[model samples]
Target: MSVRESTFPGVGALRQTGRLFALAASVVRLTFKRPFQKREFVEQFWFIASVTILPTALVSIPFGAVIALQVGSLTKQLGAQSFTGGASVLAVIQQASPLIVALLISGAGGSAICADIGSRTIREEMDAMEVMGVSPVQRLIVPRVLAAMLVAVLLNGLVSVVGVLGGYFFNVIMQGGTPGAYLASFSALAQLPDLYISELKALIFGFIAGVVAAYRGLNPGKGPKGVGDAVNQSVVITFLLLFFVNLVLTAIYLQIVPAKGS
Candidate 1:
């Protein structure tokens, strides 16, 4: 009788596990590092905001208008057209703002971050940093992750306010609802909890997206093909994870929060 010993069950499994742990450790340590470099953070912040803003604004404004139009038309048919304002406010604050921001960020900043790090990896820049006694995790990943989280929160807030206002203008001024009435409905519908949830979602999403993308990008195989594969994988994984997180958060919030007027 003879027995064959398996080589740890799979090819590269040990290396993959080690890298995974390294990435997790990087995230934890970076989170605790004090006196974070403001310059590095600001540079990443600028790049992310600039890359994401245009597409976000474009999508959100039109989404707001479409929501307004649909709700207005439906309510008009039911002789409750004024309620359109409320619907627009609720939709934008609770769902549209966060979702739209995530989409834009995933498309623009996510890919860019992944590509930047992947290119550096391919060029041995990360290795260079390691050789020079510099921690790439501290110098590169930390600042960008923190910046992405902050940017996501700020961008979502801006998107919520702008989208709601855009919807109001379209529904009230252009579509003939009274401005006073629309504002009143908007105020009633946009509760503090809704805005809080949206911002929280954005913060979580940004952190997850940044970290996941960074991990994939920084560990890609050696060369141009590897870089492209990393970028594509980053985008897909980020989007899927973002959606999954959104669902989980939504469920938790629904269960924990008291119902309106309850």
Candidate 2:
């Protein structure tokens, strides 16, 4: 190998990336070839939702309020204060809501998945499953990943509605914005695709989170400490991937979908 390729750091990261992609690919293939695990999927869906719903709702209120306050301030200065609703709504629905779901899912739900799987790995439950001729990826990983995707998509809508209402509440009560103007601005500037992209982002982010967590869980380093470390790594890696993917998706969407007036 060349000097840089021979280096431990570069090789380690590159190998890990390759393995993650491989696991993701296996997941996609297995997802289609399934005697689908409906019960496990339902259990995982509820578990993820229970952990994420309250936090997503709470964080969104402040997130929406902040976006409204910032946009409201800028619009006031530009003498287009009535457009605050449109601007803030676009910001929350198109960007903030999905990001909120991604962050929370990775932080709470993803970590939990990682830790759960990691714990099982260290305990040899995964090995036991393999010995019994059960494919752990199909038995465990696929359902969790699908559940995460579904939950993320549903919660994206929840966050969108809650965020918009929160923004509306703060804008009207604190910023002296009229409800009619706020609602009208949304109608004027926002369109259906904004919501579409937000939900799509959520779906992809969930898939990323679930696959990363399951991958780490499946290949935890060594022992209890290793499992703990893997859990942390999974969360951090998923977060980084989420933002990078979000950037790419946003760029692609912008290119493909013309803005409201343009």
TM-score, per-candidate, Cα-based: 0.85, 0.94
Off by over 4 Å in 1: 1-25, 173-175
lDDT scores for all predictions? Answer: 0.78, 0.88
lDDT by residue for model 1 (228-254), tens: 787787788788878888889988987
Report the number of the highest-lDDT candidate: 2
